[model samples]
Target: MENANVLIVFVSAILLFCIAFSRLITKAGIPVLVFFIFAGMIMGSEGAGGIYFDNASAASSIGNFALCYIIFAGGMATSWKSAREVLLPGALLSTAGVMITAILVGVAAHFLLGLTLMQGLLLGSVVSCTDAASVFSILRSNNMNLKAPLAPLLELESSSNDPAAYMLTITIISLMKSDGGGFFGYALMFVMQLAVGAGLGFAFGFAGALLINRIRLNSDGLYPVVAATIASFVFAAVQLMRGNGLLGVYIAAMVMGNVKLVHKTSLVRFFDGFSWLMQILVFVTLGLLVFPSQLRAVWLPALVMSAALMFLIRPAAVFITLSGFKYPLKAKLFVSWVGLRGASSIVFATYALTEGIQNADTIFNMVFFISLTSVIIQGSMLTPVASMLGQLDKEDKTLVSRSFTDYEEDIQGTLYELRVVRGSKAVGMAVSDMKFPESVRIMLIKRGESTIAPTGKTLIKEGDTLMVTTGKTEALLALKERLALV
Candidate 1:
């Protein structure tokens, strides 16, 4: 027990260092998630740290929790206005499209590697869903514009596909382990899982929101904390009822995020950071759970499966499902390329490991390798590749931007004051001329706090709080780099 604290501290320190390093390399477009996991591998039992952790149960639970945070955030970030146009196609893709991808990959795996149909499908199902965190983060970060409903379609696709893939994976694993099970039984199980999960998630999410709306806490911060509990409870309740709790959580959060609620910005910020933390932990811990030595044995088969997935299976799946859709070749190509296997794949591997399935260790290691390769290769190139495919461009600002009124947002901005100093470069320059990096918006310079509005002609003075709206980091950086201000 005494050494436990020491181990925790050591692991935590490694995580912090990896996170810092990841941030430093964002310019290279490699996601921070990839870095966190790789750092875990370097510190694992096979590596220098000599930490042997084969606790499949523990890893699975953590992975599930991490996925919940991710799904909730994805839902919150989605806009109803944008989501409406994509709903029809999105549903079709999540249900029908996911099945198609799984089948194609399964077929390829069977033919190429001579694996059984079920085994092929399991591998296919594992990587079918586009990673929710990776998709949302990259799309928003690059400000990639989709053709009208197409953006929302992809967002919804990524958000909802997890449930179906997860169902298939679990059911197949069960059937494999069972003495016997007919086709009708398998179908019934799948339908039951989907219906139950959706029903429970909706009920819990709606009820939670109703309860939360009435609770006027002393502090506004309580709202987010309450919502966090709501998310977890909604997921747990659904899972306990033999439903797809993961899917339920996402739908519930999407509804909540779109509701007319107070403190929206604060809520978004809270979830964004929370989801990031979850992703870091999920990826890193999953990495440590893998043993590198067994990986060599699985190398041949894993690579065979990967090639079929990357080239043959994914493209076939995309083409079949998108048959009637108006998506261009570029969008289709980009979509096929970005079908990453991240947290969910790792979780599925955990499932395989825990069930005492055949070759579980080898499968886990193989998956860990594939996930690393996919995220680093596909994840790092998402922006560039999308840009090349004409699906994304650097000139775009953001898909989601907030509009501010003269009073409301401005009044809020004044609370975070910005000042123009005497002899400051901004003094003589026209508000537009100085080219402020969208950080500070000049509101009003006060000779005193009584309220004096600054017009376009307003001059600057030292020791005056400029009453400008600015991004915290941006404002500080601007002051240091451009104005030499403290």
Candidate 2:
């Protein structure tokens, strides 16, 4: 118990410091993830704190759990409307693009680094997918508001591609351990994972949406708790059934996100913060698992592989996969540039080590170095690169965008603050009776200290503060007149 207390205190201190340090790093055009990784390195065994950790399995376990929340949050935040436009191209990027990148990298690794074809392919598969945590964190934290379609495309690809990457990683590992079944077996396995995963995800997501809307929790805080727990259960169940749990959780969350649930805003807010906490924990844990000294042996190879991935392989994959699509040249280029290797790559690298592969340590160190360089170089320059491609949205002066609401770009409306006055048409009337103009809605009503979501049946009291959104200035003026706004 005494040792446990000390352990808790030490962890708590690290969390507090790292969370605060994130703010400091953001101003320097650096990715906060890079800082978190370095922080863990400083506190690691080889560094000042000297805490020894070489557990690949434990790190992988924590990473899987962290991934569930991060992917779920990304899914929940995705607006179906925006995703609809880029669905085909995005799906192509996530699936075929990952495969292409992995194959190219695998071939390069096999020839250049003297690794076995299987081992090289395994390395490729692990690092193929763009990381949701890295993309979400860097883009949202830095306010890199990429223009429409591009943002959703990238988001969808990042959140959805992990399952493909995971499939390839596990499949290659299986092949390495046996007298391999041919391409037919591998193809069948991929189909099975995706099909079963999607089916289960849809079923659970529908059930979750129904439960969230119907179940009246004792406290509002419990809403997010219940939703998240159910989502985790979906992941566990799907994995137990030999399906891709990561993919299942993401699709499930996407389903839940598109539906209206009780405490929707608060639940979204809670998950947003919760996901950030998990990312920090996962990255730091991964950092602790690495020994900087081991990195020295693989640095040169790692640098060469990283260069191939960032320049040759990634670009070729993106351009080829998106060839027949309607996206502009600049969008394709931007997509290729933003392919930042992150937590998933590092986490997947541990699979090789856990399997006791001969080259596991070398693979792990190379992956770690590659992820670090990717985030430090590509992640830091996302905004500038997007700007060069003319794909970035102008900074919005009105809404103070939080990560949760960063993707709320579709609601193109002018927000108006209005106060209800005595004897106005709106006062002492139900919100439904107010007959708000078309494209105008009362999003929130603040009556003194309490805030209401402004249901149709809710009465509008005098002196209440109303936050209304309207599509046109005329509609706002009409609302002002009816409400007798001061």
Candidate 1 runs further than 4 Å off:
1-6, 140-151, 393-486
TM-score, every prediction = 0.81, 0.83
The true-versus-predicted C-alpha distance at residue 228 of model 1, in Å, is 1.5
lDDT of 1 by residue, 1-486 (tens): 878888788888888887667645554555667777777777789987778877999999999888888888777776766677667767777888788877887787778767788777777777777777666655554445544444666677787788888888898788888888576798897899889988877777677777777888999879999999988988888888888888899888877776656666577778989999898888888878877777788788787777667777677777777878887888788778867767778788788888888766766776777766776677678777776877753333224221000111223332355565566666555444555554566555555534445444345556566555655665656654586443
lDDT of 1: 0.72
Candidate 1 residue 227 C-alpha distance from true site, Å:
1.2
Query: What's each prediction's clash count?
Result: 2, 0
Clash pairs, candidate 1, are: 418-466, 419-466
Q: After superposition, how far is residue 314 of candidate 1 from its true place, in Å?
A: 1.4
| lDDT of every predicted structure (CA atoms) | 0.72, 0.83
Question: Number of the top candidate by TM-score?
Answer: 2
lDDT of 2 at 456: 59
Looking at model 2, residue 38 earns an lDDT score of: 75
